[model samples]
Target: MATSLPSHPIGVFDSGVGGLTVVRALMDRLPFENIVYFGDTARVPYGVKSTSTIEHFTLQIVDFLQRQNVKMLIIACNTMAAVAAEKVREISPLPVLDVIESGALCAVAESKTGGIGVIGTPTTINSNAYARAIHQMDPDCRVYSQACPLFVPLVEEGWLDHPVTRLTAQEYLKPVFVEQIDTLVLGCTHYPLLKPMLSTMTGNLKLVDSAIAIADQTAELLQQQGLANTQRGMPDYRYFVTDVPLNFRNVGERFLGRNLGAIEQVSLDRL
Candidate 1:
């Protein structure tokens, strides 16, 4: 049903700048593909909001991105994906991809001992989305979940590898470690920014970075659909935000691992 061309940009959106991590992975995996990213910076921390509110905001973003003529839609925010991914799919004309499903699939495949750990925000963990998803794929695998509410702010603050971060991670992961999990799913997009520190602390535990998993999945989907960009020149990247919060540029640049070019702010009425 999609008449989208290979040259069309892919739309990726999140509650905040965390989705930039997904964008970074996409840039690495699909170098020729253009991307349009939207961050709902004005009303971030969607974790605390009601599901209906989250869904409403997500649909607004989906509507905005659809106007960009994107070939596909990617829900980069774990909370949004958990709450409104199906709703997005229902209305979207393009193929929809979500990080939660990708992360669950990757976690299931990567876990050697059928023991997997999951770390996410309180909302994501409380939703039991990851556990449900993992069980749907592999009912025999044991899922150990922990809610690390502090990781997001820590990552946004750029405290990666800091002593305070290390201590916080250790304390948060103690319960999961006790379960003896062989793979740890980074359920929050922001958590991927802490991969180096998490990897260092967790040693041999495989970390399922949803960003990388979704990027790989997107590449596969693009190839199968014959929508992969054939040209090799520089790809266009556009960023949209609801509001420019304090230190947003700095935090977003860290998450994206590069300079954010031009960021356009859109009003809610327009979204």
Candidate 2:
């Protein structure tokens, strides 16, 4: 008898729809691979949660994905990626990818003045995940970080280009602009939706989207491991959420920039 070939899908999770940004990147970057995404919407805004709570939720999602036979895992939320990535790696049998390091590396590689600004949730900023990663790669680099706790709620509420969002972006980024930084890291996954406003506020600064960087890294790793799906056939993508609101389809479609075929609501207990 021949040995069985692994036919598992890629598992991606986040605190909420923010991770759909990562999914969009993966779909564009790795068209052959199938993806399974889980959004913990009932527990949205993981940024304010305790480290222990985030870790526990992360593990539960990873375990659930393992049950679905995921070949690899991507922690798409910045808060969870910053605080619980290591713990998930310890228990996962598959390769685990996180967003913080990839975004940091990209910022370091693209910065010319050695000045980098990072914006994320309170947890991500307070943890200094981006600052630490950038400094480790280049200690001479100046790292400025700010917490934009409102960005998540704004993004979640689907207010990307609202006048209020523009004002909020200006207010939050004023300090970083004063420092004359040339690189800005969208440390939080949700922040990418606000990129247009952020760009307007930051002038000519280079904006780094962690979702894009991580997607690139994911492609390279899969190819290096000889696990890159070689199929040219249509790949299936599944979306699941802990709590599906009436506006989930509308909000998710906007976030993903495409229709989410069908979203199934699952209990957190099931995970």
RMSD to truth, every model: 1.4, 2.2
Root-mean-square deviation of candidate 2: 2.2
Task: Tell me the lDDT of model 2 at 265.
Answer: 88
In the range 53-84, model 2's lDDT, one tens digit per residue, is: 99989898888877777788999999998899
Worst 10 residues of 2 by lDDT: 1-10
lDDT of 1: 0.92
Model 1 vs. true fold: TM:
0.96
Report residue 238 deviation for candidate 1 (angstroms). Answer: 0.5
lDDT of 1 at 62: 95
- List where candidate 1 sits over 4 angstroms from the true fold: none
Instruction: State the lDDT of candidate 1 residue by residue for 55-141, as single tens digits.
Output: 999999998998889999999999998899989999987999999999999999899899999999988898899999999999999
**Candidate 2's error at 254, in angstroms?**
0.6
